[model samples]
Target: MYVGQGGLIMTEVVGMVFIIIGIPFFLSGTIGLLRLPDIYTRLHALTKADNVGLGFVILGLAIQATSWLEVAKLFLIWFLVLVASATSCHLVADAALRRNIKPWTKE
Candidate 1:
């Protein structure tokens, strides 16, 4: 609705650029997940890359947000997802270790 202002247009363009930049990170993460040889490495690729991608996307959305409250909420969601992904990755790796799953290595 706030589409008439020049500032709003600039912000929207910047936000779109951020989102476009983030897409490759997501693609690389997907590629790594498929190409990597083992669970640990796959998890590393997905969690780290995807987290950064999502962060950029969220940052872009926040930039275009109409209000401070919405911006804050977007950042909060990003932080929560960041923490959750790290925790879940750690748990999965730990479980794999406990079960004695070997990490794939180049010989």
Candidate 2:
């Protein structure tokens, strides 16, 4: 949607750029999960997506957001995901350790 009658706004263009930049972070994270050798490593990649990738996405969305309330909600959701991803990653790693899952190593 055009924010102005003349043309697209700078913020919208910047926000779209941010969104485009964010996609790779997400794809890499997904690729990491499928291709990584171990649980910890996979968790690392996924959390990168949840943290950095999602941040870019949320930021872009927030920038393009029409209302302040929407921005607030975006940030709130980002914060919650951050907390949850971190906690879950830690717990999964801890459980893996308890189960004696060895990190993959190359000789």
Q: How many collisions per candidate?
A: 0, 0
- Distance (Å) between predicted and true CA of 15, model 1? 0.9
Write down the TM-score of every candidate.
0.94, 0.90
Q: Estimate every model's Cα lDDT from 0 to 1.
A: 0.94, 0.89
Tell me the tens digit of each residue's lDDT in model 1 across 3-47.
Answer: 798987999999999988899999999999999999999999989
Considering only N, C-alpha and C atoms within 3 Å, which residue pairs clash in candidate 2?
none
Candidate of highest TM-score? 1
Where model 2 places Cα greater than 4 Å from the true spot, the runs are 1-8
